[model samples]
Target: MDCTRSYWNGRKAVHRRTMMKGAGYCDSDIKTKPHIGVANTYMEGSPGTAHLRTLVEKIKQGIWAAGGIPVEFGVPATCGNVANGAEELKYEQAARDIVAASIEFVAKVHRFDGLVTVASCDNIIAGCYLAMARLNIPTLCVTGGSMTAGIYKGQKMVQAQLDVAVLGGESEEVLLELEEHVCPSFGACPSMGTANTMQMTGEIINFVVPGTGTLPSTDNLKLRRSKEAGEMIVEMTKADRKPSDLITRETLMNAIAFAMATAASTNIVLHLIAIANELGIKITLDDFDHYASKLPCIVGVIPSGPYTVVDFHYAGGALTVMKMIESQIYTNVPTMDGRTWKELLANVEAKSSDIIRTLADPLFKEPGLKILKGNLSPTGSIVRPTGVPAEMKQFSGKARVFSSDLDSFAAIERGEIVAGDVIVIRYEGCVGAPGMTELMVTTDALIAHGLHKSVGLISDARFSGFNYGAIVGHVTPEAAKGGLIALIEEGDIISVDTVQGTINLDVPENIIAERRKKWVCPPPKVKTGLLALYAKNCRTADEGGAMQPWLDDETN
Candidate 1:
């Protein structure tokens, strides 16, 4: 029986049927067809979601053709580019939970038999996954594919390059040309940034159609796939195939293995953990490290390599990458369309070996991402080992601490930061900054100043996927909670060895203990608002930084 029947089939549901008629639905349309919720994260003027309305129209057509009713609802979707480097960045991570809760509220209230989430960008896609797991309904996601690469002065460009160029003090004409051309289309940034990473993560975990993750946003095939997703949701609902049926522990391990092979954004670690939590599965940094050790980084997508995700798409996308690493991942797990991964990838092959290399001839035999633990980060910290410059991978430097990203950025612009320095940005974790804003602005400034290879950055906050260099982020037990990062003084020595998976403070144990004894926790930045609530209750970085109330229960 259809879940919507509870609201429309009974005589007591006369008010509901009357409400549906007012909305232009016939009694038969309400009673005979299953209702599918289309949770759209489309907002005007946002590059990632501007074209989603067109996809939604096609999805509705497919739903109607399949004898199902499609109901579209709007959810919050924000751009990190707009929020970067400002106080507004604090809201970026919080928007993920807001999007998830909004979808859950709408789907539960309307009694949808199945759900189809339409989203682009980082937080929106992660939020959709969380909602799917929480609701445990037959659900499918439609990814808004990557934008086309921009052309500037006969060179291909992306958002990350533009960010650094803007701070590099280029001539007005050059800056204007780059600003106008860096984002030539309305879709996610044309790299393996958080947006594209999470999109592919969905497909790897079997929450999306097989090839939809890497299609260009303007590709006609994307529209066709969106329609197909609608039809699939109806079939999935009929079969009672929920997210729980497909996303087992082994399936999640496959997702992580794919992330490792592709050198995906470190932000994926937080998202996968959060998705697992919603399904009552326990995932930690150890799970990511386990895959990172076994899977070779094969895809040469920026900022880990020279090519863009557009190249990855043309070179066979997610399917080819999965084929390359099939031996390392689970192959018998079921996908959204009822085929095991082994069956889905039977005839796939990489079109370009340079873009998606085979496991035997991979881009980097070293791991893609690593979890570093030491006195500084008692829980753990994250770094993309594949992205770091070889010269800076295992260096010791003096500590140059800052309380905020803007302060460090200003110091970089003033030539205060130099070689052999570990720039520490603290008080910016989930409970500290109350949102754990990305540190791309400061990292971009370092690149603009030509210090990306000379200096290193460590933070309790997060970093953008476009960021590279000797950078470590997501330091646990954040400064607000008296982490070791808050106790460092200027000129104190700190060592980071990405190759060995360790980050340490050279100071003695007695001195460190004394400093911690004197350390004072700062008050919440926001006094009363959603951020204040988030600051008071959100989990630490290692625990996915989720804001759910149940997760806060120590006994649970």
Candidate 2:
């Protein structure tokens, strides 16, 4: 046989991959086989995980078929559906550290040629990004896909919103049925929320196959994509390429720009910051607004627009947005296939006007989130302009704040909170709330009374995926840490000047200074566990909501 024919026939020598994975084997097994790592996040704590296990099995088959061996590795699981508060915050930061470490350790032990990460949830996607940075391995993430759009009275909603609405005050019967109907399958959120955006970021940065990023878990297309990714990983492995090739500093900026233009989850800011920090790169909220200007808000997804990820997939997926924000994304950045961002967009176009708009008539016209500086937030904070009311864009409202998340919750349930209220959910920062937990229940209550849509939430923490309001999260120097947020009290008048890009309390400097002296940190919820660890080392949200202990390690 000719050399070409022999080379093609010899593609079946994947057994060498198994032997390289620290498994005892004879030299005969060491053929010129490509080894692939299947970094699968399959744990019972999260519902979307089941799909990953099933998907990994298919990846294994595809690796063998492509003349590559696939070694599967597992990482810690973070279940958003169950955990809440600082404990959840504890897990979020830990997830990133754990995944990055796991991938590095596993790859070194297995000698894998490339990696295929199977993930879907919000934390999982972020964790995978950190993992990709650590191993710097030829990597690809095949998301389980967002869950089918949840329906209520034939109207579709995402899972997080459904949970929030019910928890806030809807009847248990309605919530139960809606919960069952809302997320009927195992997938990611269909909304243009954090989970969907992060997964697509992987594709836009040329981390995953472009068009394959938005398929849902139940769709057969996801399985086909998984197989294709398996094959792609084998090819990447043979090329000795790693994730850093695709996820360059330029790509990180592109991802941030996309997140802002789409008005995606606040989680992206934190996630991207952490990923950059892990890679020894610097990214700040200013970069978020910097790229936000050139990019247009054309993506038609919820909280920002009217569609879901399902509609986005059929319309154009990441390619659609990339084409719109081409200028924002440096076309020079390298990709997984050794190509540039422009090369990836060559064959793609915005197929549907509804899914992806053009700059001439962009949906948002500018980035959805804006960075504001004021006496209130000396460092900075990010807020979704789309979630806020147009009339109150430049409001000088009173600071009807809560000292803590629990007090905020109590006020909402008691009907004490109302529209035009500048609800301050404080002490829930990296060192304060120590977990940056979502006050979904409180936001839901405001939603129930039609107050959520109008009121603005300013806090030193995070929000739920389902939320839509003029909520501002991740306030720096949080109340517990003695930031201006602690000085806010119930009935204290405050001001929000979006036009001027400032958020400040109306109180005099002398009075505010007096309030500061009396402010005290809230007591710890738990005396032990990761929460304790988080309390001891976690930084403010502006610092990527990560543990401060690791801060010195990176610098060291």
Candidate 3:
């Protein structure tokens, strides 16, 4: 089997087939060389994908010891800890159409020449960033990393945010013997939420492998960086280099300015507004609040900070926050490693000022993430812009609507919240909760009973970058398209500003024309499967939470 390679149709195939051609090995040692697919989301009760099947058996022994011919594939997970009896928005729109039609049917019907993805959590890296902007091949995303330090009762706890803080006061067979040494084969939950801020902002926009996004998946440098990413993907399948040659718009505005100075996850502004509308490029949460008011939070982990994701990979990853915002990045885009994010932060070395912070010394002067714009998100709602406060950023509050999330966890078990109320959730979104759950046990029981600075979670759909407060996510004509957060009521007043991005509902227009003459439109939660084709082709998180016909050719 002359060192592998295969492609049955779109050219190249002296041999080597098998999406399952009876598993053996050489097809004339993969003729015509260069077929590297590897996608692998992995779930059957993933102990974080059992360290991704031992880093896919060392990336198939480094793609057959590096001659290129690694066809491995399997994507199907997102139960978010086995949520039991299905229909959890059909397992999140069947994980965004099984990673958008399996990277457009494995690169135009078995026409591979590079694709590696891997993934860890949070809807497997938002369905692998909408299948790497629709599989522009020669890809490389390997994040079967992060899981170590869990130790409850004397602080430090991560690996699955189940900080029952003493396992919710013990008993119950010591929570079944600490779930048998709590699933660690390291690889996700070095806690900075949304699966380590979308795979370290998908390797600060190169889609993984520069400081291998917080390596850990039970280390050995994640099995020698998964066999040096299968010998650097046979030199990116003989130098073809796809992934839209380094996802542009100046590297997606340096990954929305490093997810706005690491205040990451409002589901990374809904998967960077559906991977910049699958790359027509228009990412707004007001361009994540104009790059979170001119960037500079410097990797302060967690629901906002207190580290993890292996404490942001020993405080270096994103090459030391791109060398402390090296003049707010764009240093001529290009990477998967052809060089430049200013040549990998020219030897970065910022070993902590409390995990990289100092653009003239700063941490929380704002930019955890906030971008609201009135009439209850008239196409704007996202709050986290750093541990919120400043009088809970201009809310008027009173409304407490909750038509779902199990009637707001039965009003948090009938404690029917008080202290400046305003929790409005609804039938969730993405064309009617066809997959937008994660309010994370009512935003961690309103931040473990401190009323997290006087409550404020207003949604339509989407949450859980692992809990933090003053919530408001992806709310656009949601309430299943009847927006106005379903013409809200229960004691309306709802203001919410978050630094002028808005959420208003201080109603007036004839009491919203008397509730739009009694709106109805509810019925289609699952007319059939794949959440009835993403509730008939999803779109509207102000047009970039994907499915506006899978965005691209520069979306309108």
Candidate 4:
């Protein structure tokens, strides 16, 4: 309505008008129309983002058709799979801040009417969601869809954490064969890892249009969805519907419900907290237990079950899952379509009962997520209890200490790590590692070493969504922050009871107190640049490792 606020008369407008003219935009095209920002996180060398460059064009076409001028821009995305095994992986979490800042800068300085945030994977989507909340603009999201399952020896082979984790002990012959076939397409990992998990979370939270998350990138349906999202943002702008309108306390709870019901990534827990922090919701890790305890794990997809995200999409995507759990969701909550959740799910149903299981016959007996508190993680810790057997849920073992994932992985390869030991990887938290690196490789390595069932791993780090076993992570206050995890020593009896939701380091209370007094925080691994800045700003994993203050609890 007031498009000239950003252009047409003043000195700032003169510069904007000149730029538009230099780009060959006609007066009619540049005047009196809503200017929508298409913030695309498209990059080469990463399968997750490679296709987005082409997909953005379709979005632009839809914007033009809906009487909006599409202003396209770039955002950075890290391919966690491609950057695996190097120091580069340590900066992955830091990139989330970068992605959010870039989008916020463009939207604020340019004064766009609405925004369309597009990306795949954890940090990228989380960053965009944060930007949307920070800007509080008429906004929508389009996820780069899931990769199709690869066919290996007539069996469906998906690119999953299980595939990566097992590489540690695989024979050379098997490794050679897997390198070519594990991920043969350009999309996020086929399994329900962080990318797919975040995408589905976006849908559940109503940040994106329903049912658009898990479509295969190669499918024409994904293109149509992107185009539709572009069109929808223009309508959203017209109706004055903003991101803050859709992402609310109820919607955020609904997102947690989806994550739990699907047995989604533990990483989702971190991202969700970061997002809620941006909205000034002050969501804590303990808040998650309420939703997790109530919601049943329904969808049996990857890491947790036999199927991949493709199967989940075909079985009815996020809307279908929401429908099955409608009784649990706040149905009065609004969605991107400017309708209530009840309106959106009025006709939604699961296509197949087998893939998307019902509450009556749920996939997991307990909630997928477990928030534990004990001497080891008095601040708290997180673990995925789904897919973990009853015996592994409650166990006690001697601690086998390792300072980092690489050290533990090397020990496993050298046959030094054995069953019945609780692996402790410390100094890898948000502040400790500075980026809080994914522990998928280490978890995979242990599984490959044939000790996943017998051994348990605890860390101040995180696990990939593909990870399964008695592994517990996100322990806080982390080693660098003077948490008790840093005080743990070799052969100390470590107990983890997932059923009871407690993880403790069995030691004398006086000894632990003495250790806390004498313990000195390690020097920042990264002394300068973004990592150092992030180390200074980031809160604990229990608070979602959020750099923002609103997400943090000072009392803890």
lDDT of 2 by residue, 387-412 (tens): 66676677656677665666776787
Clashing pairs in 4: 165-444
Candidate 4 on 1-556: residue-level lDDT in tens? 4666645646667777888879877777676788899999998878889889778998988899999999999998878876565567777787888888899999988788899988888778888887888898898888888887777677778766435535655677776776677777778887778889988888877677888877888789888878888888898888888767778888888888887888888888888888877776777777778876787788888877888887778878888888888888899988877789899888785554767877878977778787889888887788888857566889889999988888888888788888788999999889988889788667777666768888899999887777888988899889898888999889999999998888998899998888788888888888899988899888678777767753336445
Measured against the true structure, the TM-scores of the candidates, in listed sequence, are: 0.98, 0.89, 0.35, 0.96
Error of 2 at 268 (Å): 0.5
| Every candidate's lDDT | 0.87, 0.71, 0.70, 0.82
| Model with the higher TM-score, candidate 2 or 4 | 4
Candidate achieving the largest lDDT: 1
Top of the candidates by TM-score: 1
Worst 10 residues of 2 by lDDT: 1-10
lDDT of 1 by residue, 1-556 (tens): 4555567888899998898899998889888788889999998978899989999998888888888899999998988889878988878788888888999999998888899999989888898888989999989898888999899878899999988988999889998888899889878997888999998888888788888887888789888888888888888888889999999888998988998888889899889888888887888899988886788788899988889887888888999988888899889999888889999889786554888888889899877788888988978999998888888889899999998899999999888999999999999899888888788789999889989888999999998888898999999878888888989999999999887789899999999889878888877778789888888767788888878768657445
How many backbone overlaps does candidate 1 show? 0
**Candidates ranked, most accurate by lDDT first:** 1, 4, 2, 3
Clash totals in order: 0, 14, 22, 1
At residue 478, what lDDT does model 1 achieve? 84
lDDT of 3 at 261: 79
